[model samples]
Target: MTVDWDWSYTGDILPDLLKGLRYTIIATLAGYAIAIVLGMVWTLLRRTPFAAVNQAVRWITEFIRSTPLLVQLFFLYNVLPSWGLSLSSLTTGIIGLGLHYSTYTAEVYRAGIADVPRGQWEAATALNLPRSRVWLDVILPQAVRRVIPTLGNYLIAMFKDSPLLLAINVAELLHEAFEVGSKSLMFLEPITLVGLLFVAVSVPSSILVRRLERRYATY
Candidate 1:
């Protein structure tokens, strides 16, 4: 069987796909920023001296990681409005993505912080440094640097996962492809374009992350 290809149709749908791509990139960057910041917060919370706070944070993180992100998005997008906490679809999508991935990033942070030489903590204690100063000056710098490549991997995962936001009506890349395909009743061109676009972006990003890991391997 011969398959028909439509170059003209592909050109016509390019604009919509590109527009979706813009939203995808925006969502990925915004969500990843939230994940990075909140993940560190979660890790620190779990490290608090109080057992209750540590247990609470541990439970919360585990819950977020254990559930499906789509369910979280639906709850945020659909259920919250009834509780007078309504949010825009895009906003809800970003929060869901960020909240879900923050758990994973928190684990990455925990590992990074653990890998810091024990002597660094001893030095901070001997210096009589304040807790904040110890973290900001002595610990986080090394931990964050060591985890940069792993964090970048999460960012790439977040980018690929941004399509899940379409469930909440966020118009990301795969959503636009579906719209184009549905209108024309031709799935081949638009879907193929989406795959190609994802590959184009993700491959280079993965390569960069690998290079970073190699560069920092000795540090």
Candidate 2:
């Protein structure tokens, strides 16, 4: 069966999709920043020498990782307001996405740190470097470089996942597609465009991440 394409409708819907695309990108970038920062904090906490702090961070991270993101999003959206806490849909969505992904990123960071040679730590100790100095000046830089590719992969994943914000009425790309399609009675073009846009962005990003990984590997 041949599929009919509607160029005119697609053209009419382009502006709305572009607006939504802006929000999607903004949310993705903001969420990624939060994830990276919070993930580092979580990783550091778990690696701390204090047994209680390490155990607490591990339990918290495991709980978050085990829970469904949708459930977490809905809980944040619906449950918090009853206790006098309220946030805009965009804010809630960004926070939820960031926190949810931070769990995964923390594990990535932990693996990276673990992969660092024990000799490096021993050398830091031999030098009488303070703990913070050792982490900042020596360990973190190397660990983060080793895990850059994995972290980049997560950013792409988070970008694609931003569409889930539409569930809470944050008008991201997919939400705008649905709105455009419902209003104009032309679902095919807008939906197809959204899918194409995601691929267009994600494929190139994945390639870039791979290239960076290869370049860093050579060093």
Candidate 3:
């Protein structure tokens, strides 16, 4: 009595599964957006001349990178309430994802910044360019171009990690699949669909990142 696949049963649950997929996509986009901005800020702070500021940023980034993302998500969603700061599950997931990944992305940004030519800095200094204008117009533009591939890779990583939002009850794709499969006792089809959906997206995204790398080749 081993019934493997049922097309009609899968069809019945497609809508609910799609709803979860939508939430997963939204959370990934929101979280990545925040992570990009926060990571850039951290990278810029790391460049500050003050030793204390640099050390503080380094220590904090290390602390975040060392921690498990699941624990961080729980702390933000559950424990923050005790400190008079509460967030919705989706918002908590977004912030938690942002903070966790920003630590890694900051290092990517730092590497990009380091790749900028020393001559460019010297030229800016010779031209009497304002510090802000030099950094804004010259450095970041070049650095961003160099780092797009790295950042895109992080985007894919963040997309995959979005399922962890289930810890905060965000109802992302895998969580939704689990819910439906649990009730119907048909885990195979729903879970298979989830894997297919992830593969369908991730493969194309990885290809796009590779193209971006070629586009920005050092040569």
Candidate 4:
């Protein structure tokens, strides 16, 4: 079967595609904000001295990391309303993405923390620094700087995965492409555009991360 290519159709749907791109960016940024903060909390919780609490946190993080994100999204979108906690599709997508990615970010944080020199902790103790001050003033600053490239890579990954939000009708880039295809019967243009959009964003971001890694390696 010969497919008739439609250049005009691509032009017609450009606006809708751009609108979807906006939503994708919003979801990525908001979700990443939640992920970064919550990941730090999870890392801190897991590092506490209490064996049972730390173990529980480790187990939960592993569970979230190991499970499929689609299941988590469906659970957040469908199950929460039954408990009387309704959320808009966009909100649900953001929360689900945030929580799911937080597990990965927590692992990143844990690795960064573990990479810190043992002598630094001993020096902090010798200086009689409070635990909170030791972490905030000494540990976290260095740890966060070291992990920025990894976090940036995750941000790129999260941005690409934002299309999964369409499963719940969040209307991100790929969702808008589907809507355009459904109405106009021209799936190729919109779908191709979506792929290009992701590549355009992700490629440069990835290059930046690599550059950051190289620079950090120097110090």
- Model 2 regions lying over 4 Å from their true place: none
lDDT measured at residue 10 in model 2 versus the true structure, 0 to 100 = 83
Clashing pairs in 2: none
TM-score for all models, in order of appearance: 0.94, 0.94, 0.94, 0.93
Candidate 2 per-residue lDDT over residues 81-132, each given as its tens digit: 9989899999999999999999999999999989888999999999999988
lDDT of 4 by residue, 1-219 (tens): 987768888789889999999999999999999999999899989878999999999999899999988889999999999999999999999999999999999999999988888898999999999988998999888888889999999999899889999999998989999998988777888999889888999999899999999877627
Clash pairs detected, candidate 3: none
lDDT of 3 by residue, 24-140 (tens): 999999999989999988988998899999999999999999999999998898888999987789999999999999998999999998999999999999999998999899888
For residues 1-219, could you state the per-residue lDDT of candidate 1 as single tens digits?
878999999999999999999999989999998999999899989988999999999999999999999888898898889999978888888989899999999999999999999999999999999989999999988987889899999999999999999988889999999998999999999999999999999999999999999977735
Measured by TM-score, how close is model 3 to the native structure?
0.94
| Clashes found in each candidate (C-alpha, N, C closer than 3 A) | 0, 0, 0, 0
Worst 10 residues of 4 by lDDT: 210-219
Score each candidate by Cα lDDT: 0.93, 0.93, 0.93, 0.92
Global lDDT of model 1? 0.93
* Model 1 bad stretches (over 4 Å): 126-133
